[model samples]
Target: MERLDGARGPRSPDRRGLPARGLRRGHPPAHRRERPGDHARDRGLGIALSPGFLSAFVFPSFRRLWIGAFLSSIGTWTQDVALSWLIHTRIGDPFYLGLRTFASELPLVTFMLVGGAQADRVDRRRILLVSQVFQMSMAGALGVLYGLERLGIGAILVIAFLTGLAQSQSAPTYQATLTSLVPHDHIPNAVALNSLQFNLSRAIGPVIAGLLLARVGTGACFAANVLSFVAVIVAIARIELPPVAALGRESLGQSLKAGIRHVVESPILSALTLLGATASLLAFPLITFLPVLAGDVLHTGAPGYSLLLTSLGVGAIAGAVTTAHRGSVPGRGKLMLLAFMACGAATVGAVLSGRQWLAMALLAAAGFSLTTAFSTLNSLVQEHAPNELRGRVLSIFGLAFRGGMPVGSLVAGGLVNAFGAPAVLAAFASALFLIAAAIRLRNARLRAL
Candidate 1:
């Protein structure tokens, strides 16, 4: 039988039409095995392409989905900027801004695991479609309310929370769905391209939001975001995904426990997840304290802050491109470790440098290292995870990544408030460097990934 993705079923045949051999004991499954030159693409003319960063686009499903996601992500970032601007201009309180951030992020910490469980149990395509519709509705509501001059802080907070809740469900399902869209060899390229699109959108979206806010106003930004969802919704509706097979009948608590246990039992997964959380806790807070660094240390004010953020986004895009070009290169595990160290070192250099130009340059390097380490870690996790448990595993990763940000920012904020941004940030960067060094020295298995 042909799969929904237009590929032959596993039981179909070998290239010569004979039955495929069954797996032998002590041998890894065919999907899990990696061979040298696996990422290379050979055309009929005998020309070979290495790394094959664009190979995932050979599949119509992945290509359509990627284009849709790219458009939607730009809109999402636009809405984010618009929302923050709306809250700041209207509420005029730092406390409310922080509250909005917290509301928008809390659901990832609380409900992402549940979403992961559902990904394993139900139809992911439907979940994505529903999530897109829900988020689009919320964005529309915000736009309409603001247009009518009836938007309240309470209304904004509630909508933000609901939208975040939907994200908690959709994010893991989206991650889990990538492997289904392409063959195993293309997973790394697909994953890297996914990161590339996100970082690209992250760079482009804010600039668009700034233009919209300056010329047309916040209402236009929100309205644009609502319309952007149509691309992703249409793409999701069109993709012919393989049906999800239920993994188990466990209760939510039990399902979560199983995922946690799987991670705990596997040292590689546990280490990778911990490293990600550590980066979030220590390295990423540099972004949170950037304004302080700009105003206090650099003395560049708002324009400086914008420049610094732009530099970081540029570096992240470069890093994503690098990962896509590398594909499934060996020593990615070691590369990730080095990236952690580089990220920490660059962040420290940026924090210590009083010169604005030097600081921006260092921050760009930090952003590049951070993105490289993250995309590499993500590729490694996807490679090692069994399909049966992939959704749950990825959810744990998402939880660590998303949950760490708020907590880290909160702690880093307090520390900065007490000790000042430069001092606190320097210490955090130092810790991140030491942690990566220690992991590199101790985790031999991880180095082999």
Candidate 2:
């Protein structure tokens, strides 16, 4: 079978029957189109990249970015766990936990669109470079504060907010760049590989952070995260891209409106946004509250918290790797629906399970399902949107993806205090399952996708 770009029709495979090659100058990138037939469906789900799943990797720029992103992700996961543990042990309140999560995400909601607009208007590589520097400084500052034993919850929140703001600038640029690095035909492969890198880092970073926290302290993980940014910076410096031709500049307000209008007008984008938002709001809150569960319900210390995070990451890795290998699966809408249900089911199981290992296992299952579903959706969004609007389209995705998780975390943080973590999680998980089923039943077009 030949590889298919969800847009721009079927790609001609090379002598070895792999997608001919990745994006290069002289050859314009594939334009966007709505995939409405079985062939379109196959492009969405049945991406048949043979001669191995690493075909996109044949492109030097993408491979460099891929490796760089993977290293950077590992550092991020390490810092994330360490920070959560620090806040949990230091603040010792569920409200603070939620507050911390909110602080991290509030910046994304506020600045993501602006960032997306900037990505469209400027050199994405420069955006990444500046953001990486900003984030590295924040991480280093946190490490120093922690080492001095002077970091308060307020300071922690401040730094988290700052780092998230930098992320807002970087994420859309990075995401939009992936499209440029590979030809349209290999997009699904690129998206899956990126997810695979993320989950693999997620799987390992926490365990490493766990060990460091158990023995050395949080400072080590923070310092490691600082170096990780440098790795990505260097990678960006080394990879060369063609000079972007100037487009007619729009005012910031106009650019913002244009991006939002695109998403609002596209049914598939709107529907996917709805599902991702709901799931993030009701179901993904579990991630923000996992440390609380570790401490209150399981009575495990930092080690237990790390183990729990590692379990989820491990499951996510499995899911990402499977998707990367399979290339595609038919009926993506149904896959997302199933994945959403599985996440809720797993959360329910975790809520009921009293034992730590059992809870970890269930969380792992939930992670697997959630990652698989979202990665597919991510690919779809990347494929469906026109190249000109890629940054803006993905920014809308970033808003839904990062924006909802924090607000949910904030709410869950307070709700857990009132109703207990177990009860709060169970209630929301049930709600999520019902919502998913209802959408599946009502939206035939969603199913067709």
Residue runs of model 1 more than 4 Å from their true location after superposition: 1-51, 85-98, 148-153, 248-254, 289-304, 351-356, 419-422
TM-score of 2: 0.88
Residue 235 local lDDT, model 2: 67
RMSD of 1: 8.0
Give the lDDT of residue 188 in candidate 2. 79
**For each candidate, what TM-score against the reference?**
0.82, 0.88
The number of clashing residue pairs in each candidate reads 0, 1
Over 1-449, each residue of candidate 2 has an lDDT whose tens digit, in order, gives 00011100001001111111343344432222212222223224444334346666655566566777678777888888888888888778888877887887788778888887877888776777777778788989988998898888879989988877777777777777776766677787788888777778878988989988888888999998988876677667755443443558678788889889999999999888777777778876787788888988999878888888888888987877776766655688888787888888898998779889999999899888878877787887887788778878888877887777788888888888889998998988998889888888999988877
Candidate 2 collision pairs: 45-329
Error of 1 at 319 (Å): 0.5
